[model samples]
Target: MPSLNKILLFLSSALATAISVLVLGFSMSIQWVETTMDCTSSGSSFSNGSAVVTLSLFDGTMTRIHCPFFGGQDDFEVFPQLAGIGGTPLVLHGLVVCVLVLCLLFSACSILISLYNSVSNPYETYMGPIGVYVCSSLSASFSVVVLLIFAVNVNNV
Candidate 1:
């Protein structure tokens, strides 16, 4: 029984670690960009001349260098602005899916282990000190990671 708990703990910890590393890798590639119209003018012939708009990466709320124009018409030939990661959205979505799957797997395993221990070893004597410690620690740690990841996803959205 104790060995079973240890197995559950090992699995949960390994899964959580894998998920955190993966999320951090994906987040590393993410960047936020912001574009602001510095200036604009209306040409005499109804053809308005707008100042060259620049898009720059946001560095802690501060705009960085100018981003190259993506090319688009914005009511007046305004360049298509950029304000997100260079990587495709599909790539980011895949990474997110991987992280969520890992989280769900760990959460389910933890819950199942806890339930099994409660029913099979209700006497409390059956669970050795090490086994109890490992089980509880793993469940708590993975729960915390889940919460953190959820918060990160919410903020990203």
Candidate 2:
């Protein structure tokens, strides 16, 4: 029978795998930033309704996030197209996604190592007790980075 330590490792690794999968799945639903800007007509009696735009994690299709700055444009009513998303904010979004993928890879490695350990004693110097800790730490560190990046992007960018 497998020792209690091995069983615990296997269970923890399984939980980590589940959490990793969830993190990746959540990334698919991108949140968009929204803004509305009112347009002014020089010859009209009143102001036209504001344009409502939801700009979120830009995939390079839109020039930039919709801001109130567009109200200054005299001919905004003529063209309905918004600017393509760009700049450092886009870079951070990509960074979050890449780090998450790395986290998932490390978590998978941890799961495999622990599962092997449950069957038989993994070599102490190579893939058992030490390996589990290393992989778990790496996965956890990457997770922290991903969270920090996402938080900063949402708050500052």
Candidate 3:
């Protein structure tokens, strides 16, 4: 017997949570780093070996290096780099993760509040929608900033 507004609110919050989870997962993936270099010879017109380096965050930071032509496969530790001057990307990543966590937490609270508001007495005061709006905006802004920082830093690298 919930109102249409309440139903929409619940659905929207759920959708936001799902989308945030997806974005966070994608962001944390190492696929973010992909580079190609040309080293062809003048007469042979052949392409040199190319390597793809990926950085992923799990129990610990990991870097995967793969070069099919050279038959080179190796993994390198990257945590030390985070302490160096080029650690801007890692710092930005941490910020993104923190913001996403906040977004998910607030959205979940919004969902629960909406459910309660729908089922409870009409006289009750509801603040869940406000929290949802604020959190959503904050999440969006932080996400954009993270993307920009990552893109610029990666390009520079």
Candidate 4:
């Protein structure tokens, strides 16, 4: 039964890690859409779009979470003043890259630890489950941070 427990633990940990990645990736993609989508015209009005976007989060039926930053009044308008011409700030892209790197790091670490535990139990101490739980939690926490940052960026937009 311990072996079964270990397998279950590993599987659930894997699932959780996958979920975390999915959540972060989805949020990132949503941000990208907001950054690139044409929102200046031919869409809902600013106030209506903002309200709908905010409500989308609670709808529970939509897979995509829209934000006011995308097409509403905010529209994440950015410009690179130092570059002479106008464009999105380099710092914005840098932040997104940083978040992606962190997510990848945590996901890779979780998978690696799980694989190592399954392959070699040198001490037979059964640290696999404990390790898995910790890794999963860490990844989940990082995911939350990504989500919060997304919200912040949206508002700034």
Clashing pairs in 4: none
Instruction: Give a tens-digit lDDT track for model 4, residues 1-157.
Output: 2375665666666677777777766665442322233233346555322222221111111122254344223222223321343234335434555766776777867877776555454445345667666766776676667567646655554
lDDT of 4 at 117: 58
Candidate 3, which segments miss by more than 4 Å at Cα? 1-5, 37-48, 57-70, 82-118
Q: Give RMSD (Å) of candidate 1 vs. truth.
A: 12.7
Candidate 2 stretches greater than 4 Å from native: 1-5, 27-83, 121-126
What lDDT is obtained when candidate 3 is compared to the true structure?
Answer: 0.57
For every model shown, what is its TM-score relative to the native structure? 0.30, 0.56, 0.61, 0.51
Which candidate number maximizes lDDT?
2
Q: Please, what are the lDDT tens digits per residue for candidate 3 over residues 40-125?
A: 54586676555455655422323223323344455654445555645566676566556656655654565565556655544453
lDDT winner, 1 or 4:
4
**Clash count (model 4, backbone only):** 0
Candidate 1 local lDDT, 102-146, one digit each (tens):
544554554444444544533453343345456445645654564
Q: State how far residue 24 of model 2 sits from its true place (Å).
A: 5.2
Error of 1 at 154 (Å): 10
Relative to the true structure, how large is the alpha-carbon lDDT of every model? 0.42, 0.61, 0.57, 0.51
Give candidate 3's root-mean-square deviation (CA, Å).
5.4
TM-score of 4: 0.51
Better of 2 and 3 by TM-score: 3
Flag regions of model 4 displaced more than 4 Å.
30-93, 122-127
